[model samples]
Target: MTTSPALDGPLTTALVGTRRFFTRSQVSDDKRSIHTEGGRSGDAFYRDRWSHDKVVRSTHGVNCTGSCSWKVYVKDGIITWEAQQTDYPSTGADRPEYEPRGCPRGAAFSWYTYSPTRVRYPYVRGVLLEMFREAKAALGGDPVLAWASIVQDPDKARRYKSARGKGGLVRSSWDEVVEIIAAAHVYTVKRWGPDRIAGFSPIPAMSPVSYASGARFLELVGAPMLSFYDWYADLPNASPQMFGDQTDVPESGDWWDAGYLIMWGSNVPMTRTPDAHWMTEARYRGQKVVAVSPDYAENVKFADEWVAAAPGTDGALAMAMGHVILKEFFVDSQVDFFTQYNQQYTDLPFLVALEDAGDVADTAEGADGPAYRPGKYLVAGDLDIAQAASENAMWKPAVLDARTGDVAIPNGSIGFRYGDEGWGKWNLDLEDIDPVLTLHGLDAGGTASETARVVMPRFDAYDGKVAHVMRGVPVRRIGGRLVTTVLDLMLAQYGVARPGMPGTWPADYEDPSTPATPAWQEEITNVPAEQVVRLAREWAQNAIDTGGRGMILMGAGTNHWFHSDQIYRAMLVLTTITGC
Candidate 1:
């Protein structure tokens, strides 16, 4: 037979021959090329893979919580740099403003990423080898390198079985490492209970899910809570006393609505940002700003007046100012309103008189004496009855001395006692009378009079004369003094004989013979005498003023001090007395 021309040489030879020689040759050639390419391509792929792996691996050591973006750098098939990705969020061609990508510590991300001290592999020593041998023998297996054994019998034995079980060192595979960690967590939870398993983190940056889980777990386990500020002493001490709750201050809204602002011991600008902003706004709005502090602060700069008084002496300053305000007629029109509506000012005179007469027990009487006990009111001596009263007449009985039944006699008593060698005996008989009548209750004209008055003929009077004390005097002090002197002069000059008016004085007066001793003054504050007196006078004037408001703004700088609570309380007193 004749073979086809197309297949004559190779096909005919292949049909006649036993083996397919041309097919074998083609296969061989293809195999050779593939083998050659595999070596080169494999190396290149592995190199790239290893470089990418290193970059990812380095990220494990970074203490970041995704709050910032980052960049990675690789060189010679290894990660070399990692840094805050300031250029991230780039708008392709158009660059946006560079925003900081990390916290202060994140700036050093590169240093940690490229640290030479980082361990790349599990290390094993002779002791580890011995432990591996022992484990293999115990498991009825031929002794093998620990790392290899872990990979071979992952399901049968722990990758770190030797180290974990017997506290022996052993090399482990990645899978084994993960398994070991999981098992440990499970074992701990099972063995020690959730209480002992507080949390697991090498850093403070916790994921939200993790934090929630941990927090819930801790609450369930009855774990002791970690406090935010362990260094605050006043919070610990005053919280329970003031709020009856374990917190420093209640979440009260802005106090800027006050017609008068009094800042006692608070420096708004240095410490508090929001309040400082409000104070600035208040000043811009022409709201009267009063600062009562020992230190001249940024708040003082905005103050209409500043009272640099002795620290801790604020209570005295406040009481004195109240006295002055009552004596003067400045706020006389509002006295009844305050007595009936505001618990703080309602029975202040009576309370002070009680204190003066030693009528207040060690426990002291409430604002509405004979009704509530001391400490029942939020303020020291303030009672709800005082606030709930319909008129000053309703609260007048509480102000009188119940023991001797002696009350203040209004116009019947002169300003000063005269011709009284044996006056003590006669006064004793008068003290025995009913206090309502003796002290002078509501009379024909619906006015109350001083039972027995002691007038100061040399009293300083400033009527219709607008005198501006330095901005350094506290508004409360100024208000108090102005309220007392101005009101008194106005009443005396205008002949308005109203009971709770400017001309009326508090029944209780400070004994000039018993001024604060030097030792007592030094114990309370570090202010000079002259400054203390001046501030006291100004605060007094402010307290009684009719056409003013008092406002107080506390800032962080003032609050962060060791004596912040005391300072704040003092300021509160100053403001309260000034009717701010």
Candidate 2:
């Protein structure tokens, strides 16, 4: 076919066939050869040129809240097709293998590069732009004077505010945008503290360089940076309760290694498309999975069991499971494997000294009532302990010694390491040390007159089965008072009632009214009581069979709670108990 006449070139209708033109059919000016020496179709060559002219390595850095390297095929500097890059250097054999990561949000991003809605230049309200230009002229081209005139006058600022959301944004030059922005910042800072001029964007995980640029500038200007993770409530703040950590979870490849897997509110198939293959393959390898969530979550499709727990009741179910494991495995059988695990890794045996809160009816004017999270801890101040600091010796934890009357600091406890060398390490070893016994004891007589009970942090399913409030725990205590273990307090807070303990002291686990028993959990969670108890045992047994190979992959649905820390603590309880 003859090449079409060019619209912009110096060609007119009059010269359509008058000259021997340089068209696709004829390239020579002499017109001796109308076609190329080879008569083969020329469309293939041009198609190849347009399809694969050049390719540059780049990535889809758009809506994913992140980016991944992609091989972008380009023709004449225009992007055509892109695919996941495979050349990233693998780190190690153990870590999860990653693909050039992307989400469905990326598919539309290439189109958005040149979309009509793309913000190609700085923008301001049309009225504001005109007003600013008028101000500049009126102020004799002095930008600072123009800015002050526009912003200082209430009418000038109000005019733009009234036009907002009215689709009147005008393209603004970079200089004008920067000038106005700087003036606004100056005005804000002069009137208010730098902290008031806070900047917020997504946290660095999605785009570190972009985030860092804003952060660095804010830091220089003494302006506060609002943490996006905290503001958006994405942080797993419960991580620190055990030993501060995140995202160090095993890779998808490691899923095949699991004997039992729990997907706790993590929508793996949807959110983790790259890792979904591993999950499917893991099922093929015969690894069992338990999906725990409220709304029949996406990952439940892969699970052997789907425990549809009620909303916000995961903690209650978890606590009930903990009760089963602790009661069946630890208390009933005293399984050496689990007992040793607790003795080493957990704060299970840490001591909590009991303080009696006089009946709530007898509340005095200034006296503080019952407190679950104690501020201070009980210490043997008279024992002249060498490890205890002279100023704040009470903060040291007192573990039971083999000696009848003496207490010692367990080798791995926060108390033993506090104000000492190598204090930061979270090693689980309790060698050459004794854990405080989990039995009730009474300090009958002491200079500090009030009788104190040695308290363990077991949950009392019954709110007040006995006259004493077993559910109440002191968060902190001052010197010359009682102390408690973190585990003991946490358990009590969860209401894991231990039967056959003392005079009706613990709740009857079979009773649904008891807060953390499977029956009670069933009421709140809507998960059957049998499922909770069975899953707890099955999970524990699986961990034991596989040498602590059970895992739970969780995400933001549970992390965004006001009581997220409690949820994390409950998970910590189950994982620590199962040695997972």
Candidate 3:
């Protein structure tokens, strides 16, 4: 038979035409599909891309929070595919194991290694390099002087500076880029001093070599090494403010141990994909899950209750919950665990000096007495304690002793640890003194009903106005000065209307005018008063029942506000009071 002209020529003879080698596959009787057998050979070529010579264990080196172990399959010398390693260490016998901890981004992360958009080499800004070259020629090839010439000129500086963020970079050699950086550093050090040449880099955990090298170089040059947390605004200011540490938080696996979990402003399912299962698994163990978000977030589906607060108004909702906790568990009736924990672990028992606001025009008197503002903590130096007049005595705070009902200076204060080595007790060991948490029952100089109404900072009040609350504060006249415990001032700050007190404590949770009432918080947080009340009760109950297994998983989402410290501090009050 005569072949078609399309496949007859010598030019076409070399080409592999499927028509000559194979017949058309028959269609199915139903006419919905076709069957082909020999064409499967082509799939082998595609499958060969996945055939690897070696498998290497590695991890993604970005600023990823999930530093998951990965098995990278390499063919010849190139990575072909990756798989999650299943050899993660067991958390505990009862807890869920941490295996296969990776996300989609991590799975496709290897593609970036060979992507066209990857920066495989150093690049210099086009305008900057042009200026550098011109300056180098004019300055007789002195790189430092050439860099100085460009930076010193206002017009030249503006030309390159304004070109930034417009993306006009050119390929550059590694040596040339290093030389340019050195020149810039030398010039900056000479002109503005080494203090001005601060260095900031990537997270050290991911890029330890680069981070350590840059840190060492900056340190040698007397330049301050800026922290990555403040640079990226992910400092979690509340941690340092509350705990005297920036990174003292519990690990993600700790979620399994939490009896009551609150996912506040953290989208665990979406962003933290690897750690999301800990929440679900914890729920299987009868753990209560609550989601605190403005919108219906991905994590809300997993929550038993969703507290939809107004955006950036979490501080208000938290303060309201704190009010409920302080009312029921602290002020109304003290839980034994809460009382013991607060007395031993927290600064609530530390005595504070009441500043005399004699000339202040805004000082208003409550129905019981004149309002006084809280001052610094009353230290050992302020009174004649056992350690009075000792070196660094000012740092040791005084507390009311439950055994003697006297102001006793504790030994584990900063004074004992810092200046004097003779004062060896640097731990929270109470030794013999039983520090009293609240002065409600224990009489001071006056009757148990007698209390101080104090003025403290209330950031979420009327148009950012300060709030004044009245509470029963048992005071002591020591060394011709009046002092009250931090617990009493904190109660006043939270607007917890104690028994037998007067002034602006909310009539009830329904009272809308008070600062921290659930109903008052409704106007700010848009969360229902009933929800806040219920959640607060449940949270406190959970903590009491489980011995402080209540946990809140907070992240950068909530810690990025203007007054993030205050916002976190507000929620932290709930856990602190509940001893969670």
Best candidate according to lDDT? 3
Write the residue-wise lDDT of candidate 3 on 1-580 in tens digits: 2346556565544332333345565444433344555877878966976788999999886777678899999898988889999998877787788987999888998788889998889999999999998899998999999999999999999999999999999998999898899999999999899999978867786699988898888898999998777754633667777766766245788898899999987899987888899999999999999999989989999999888888888888998999899898887787989988888878899888887554341544243446677889989888866677788888889888989878887666778887655456887888888888777766543346456656654455447755444444667666767788888877777778766555667689999876788998999888999999999999999999999999988766676667766777887787887888
RMSD of each: 23.9, 9.7, 6.0
Please give each candidate's TM-score. 0.33, 0.70, 0.84
lDDT of 1 at 570: 41
Candidate 1, overall lDDT? 0.39
Give the total clashing residue pairs for model 1: 56
User: What local lDDT does model 2 show for residue 423?
Assistant: 60
Q: Candidate 2: where are CA atoms >4 Å away? A: 1-69, 87-109, 112-184, 247-250, 353-373, 377-383, 389-398, 402-405, 410-428, 440-469, 472-480, 499-510
Deviation in angstroms for 576 in model 1?
Answer: 3.8
Instruction: State the number of backbone clashes in model 3.
Output: 1
Whole-model Cα lDDT per candidate? 0.39, 0.63, 0.80
Model 2: lDDT equals 0.63
Ranking by lDDT: 3, 2, 1
Model 1: worst 10 consecutive residues (lDDT sum):
469-478
Please count the clashing residue pairs in each candidate, in the order shown: 56, 16, 1
- Residue 578, model 2: lDDT of 74
Model 2 TM-score is 0.70
